[model samples]
Target: MTTDPQILVQAICTLACYSYLIKENFAYRIAEYTLVALYTSYQITRLFHSFIKPYWQNYAIGEKQYYFILMGALGLLLYTRYAPPQYRWLARYPIALSVGWGLGGAIARSPRPVFTQLMDVMRPLNTANNVLFFVFFMAVMSYFFFTTGKESKFIQGSGRLGRYIMMIGFGTAFGNTVQGRISLFLNRLSFLLTDWLGISI
Candidate 1:
């Protein structure tokens, strides 16, 4: 049997990765360790370049001395994971600030796209599509009602219809998830075959 060099290299790498399925051995361990080391090195380099250097240059040397102090405080707060229970409260300040800023940013932008845009799409009072949409909306809302007090027959029927709607939504979500996993697998395979093994597609 004849074998091309590139194809042979690709086959070897694929086998090395898949070997873990049979048993844990040297090849799988080497591949796993290499990936972890590479990822760690990449993250360290990125953190230095993205956060440390820029802040040191722009804030440490520039007029933004407050930012430098804030950064130092935040860094110190992160180390509080090793500190005692009473000192742990210091970490909450930065965490709360981060969450509050994030929430404020999201709230500022949410009304236009999520609320106003949806409201703008509402049709006039006399269209069939609008009537059907209102029915669907009411049905979906009925399904979420936890206080099962005196519900009308229509509301109960609407809740049943909502269950079918949710089933279709869930099926679509599952199918999309499967497709995403397959795509990620194919991406890794392409990297191993083409880049690492120098095999043409």
Candidate 2:
């Protein structure tokens, strides 16, 4: 096997991680702590490069955007949560502002995709799949209707069908997730046995 320094370190770390599969021990704990440290360092570096530096460059040098200063003050209000009890109420201001801003942004961007989906649902039922989709959409909408319980036969049937459709969708998603994880595990095993150990198979 070619003893490349980077590959050797990576293989050691991978082996340390896989040791957890046998039983969690010192090697696994060391690997976990190493990964956490690396992740935290990467996150701090990203925050500096992506957000803090950009905002600083914009507000401090080029654009001189005064509202950015206000934004900073609003963000600082979060620290009031640790202040004296009387001043802790100031924390709610930032929370309220962020929540309201997020809500409005979500509402603003939601209509277009919703309309696209509505158009898709209301499109021509030329094929069997289209017909099934139409029935499923209507049934699911019926399931969400809060006014009527399953008292009426029509509502009962639609709601039950909707529940079954939802289960099918969930089951399909879960199955794909399991298949993907299995593939990942097999790929890692191949890396260990073939790449690191240089075993011909």
Q: For residues 1-82, could you state the per-residue lDDT of candidate 2 as single tens digits?
A: 7488877887899889999999999999999999999999999999999998898787756798878878888889999999
Candidates' RMSD to native: 4.5, 2.4
Candidate 2 residue 27 Cα shift, in angstroms, is: 2.1
Model 1 poorest ten-residue lDDT run: 1-10
> Model 1: residues >4 Å from true position, as ranges?
1-17, 20-41, 64-67, 124-134, 148-150, 188-201
**Per-candidate TM-score against the hidden true structure:** 0.69, 0.84
Which prediction has the highest lDDT against the true structure? 2
TM-score between candidate 2 and the true structure: 0.84
Pairs with steric clashes in candidate 1: none
The deviation in Å at residue 163 for candidate 2 is: 2.2
What stretches of model 2 exceed 4 Å from their correct place? none
The residue pairs that clash in candidate 2, if any, are none
Residue-level lDDT of model 1, residues 14-101, one tens digit each, is 6778899899999988878877998999999999999988887888877668878766778679678679988888887778878999
